[model samples]
Target: MQEAIIRGAEFDRLDMDRVPQFLTRLVTRLCVDEARHNAIVKKMASHPRLIPHSADDLVDVVCDNAEAQWLAARLEAFSPKDRKLVLMLTSGFTRKEIAEELGTTPQGTHSALYRIRKKMVERYG
Candidate 1:
């Protein structure tokens, strides 16, 4: 569809003629991002966000509550893994569930999540 193509085509373009190398680099990154987006969307639709308790999980709670828009925007700069983890957490997935989906140990996922939260706090707090 035109909408989907437009969504994937976002990039700085006018200056590409002046800097020929930019086009290849930008196109490469766009391709990578599109692939990741497609993977994430498929995974998300099949495996829904798992918010169990509204009280214990800050990320899911924020995502469900008033701060969702702000939280989602702020996560854009995070590495793809970290961003995906945050999205999973907000969807109500426990660390164990995330680990299973990502094919890593729960402990490793926990450690990464701790770091991700620390980075987000530093950036957004």
Candidate 2:
């Protein structure tokens, strides 16, 4: 852990409140990707232990890498409108409020969000 910090792992900077959900998403992705799941399983198998501390460490490293890659892909794939929509959504704006701010109808905002989700699923899944 000290080595990780010296290498700037920055796990301490993460919001503890979001860690569970973040790990849940990472685990879900691992389940979907057979190659990654197999690799993780093989690593765990090779280091079998009653406590499995090494597996836990492996999970932490993998989760951090996966989350960084996922976010990078999301940013790369986002259109300008998609970026704006995400920004608005993150700024505590409701869809209706965002639509108003963007000079669009609420229905339009909903449609945009649906399209964004579809694109992300196609790109990432």
Candidate 3:
């Protein structure tokens, strides 16, 4: 879920309004491809080592990576408001929508996003 959020944020930063479509396409393709891959792997009786690793193991590797560590450290520096703002933004909410949800103004939401982005770039760049 954390990984998904991170990927979603990256996608949102690239193209905000396209996020829902991107996520739908991505999820559908991944599910279909995973099912096909699993079927092929299950049918194959040879080479057990050729099978793909589990999602947990892949996530573990990602969590342990230097870039992930850096990002995590950066995320830790965010205030509670900033953190929620980023999560909401990454999860596909527009500033106006997030402001309404958080009971704040759109300007506040925009400010939060700007600060979060600045912190992320300062830490990760």
Candidate 4:
């Protein structure tokens, strides 16, 4: 999580043209660690009688809830553009910044964000 925040800050500082390459470099460095951690977790999960109370179990329960499942389905139903707009907006990008990254105007980014927020409220309220 700290690393992701640092990466986001780095991304915010970079020129648009360099962002992709920076992301590629960061992902290359992180992927190996992520894979190793996942493998360890997989092995741990396979063990008999692990921790009685785990965050994974909580996540599983939440995921099984009808409301949570419905929300997940609604999120899944979003178009790629909608998803991208929401993701960028949610990740602390200003309208201008998101517009620059997406090759659109600030007004367009604002419009997209408004629609995305409305859809989220309609789905989750």
Candidate whose lDDT is highest: 1
Candidate 3 — which residues are off by over 4 angstroms?
1-74
Candidate 3 lDDT score at position 35: 100
How far does residue 90 in candidate 4 sit from its true spot (Å)?
2.7
* Tens digits of per-residue lDDT for model 3, 34-125: 99999887778456777655433444334324333444455766777766666665555656778899999977876765666677788666
- Candidate 3 lands at a TM-score of 0.38
Task: Please estimate how well model 1 matches the true structure, expressed as its whole-model Cα lDDT.
Answer: 0.67
lDDT of 1 at 34: 100
Which portions of model 2 miss their true places by more than 4 Å? 1-73
Count the clashes in each prediction.
4, 0, 0, 0
Scored by lDDT, model 4 comes in at 0.66
Model 1 misplaced regions, further than 4 Å = 1-70
How much is the lDDT of residue 99 in candidate 1?
A: 82
lDDT of 3: 0.66
A best-first ranking of the candidates according to their TM-score comes to 1, 2, 3, 4
Clashing pairs in 1: 49-91, 50-91, 50-92, 51-92
TM, every model? 0.42, 0.41, 0.38, 0.37
Candidate 3, residue 111: the lDDT equals 73
C-alpha local distance difference test of each model: 0.67, 0.65, 0.66, 0.66
Q: Please provide, for model 1 over 1-125, each residue's C-alpha lDDT reduced to its tens digit, 9 standing for 90 to 100.
A: 45654654564454435545755777788899999999987877777464234333665445433333345568778788877776776666766777889999877877886686678789867
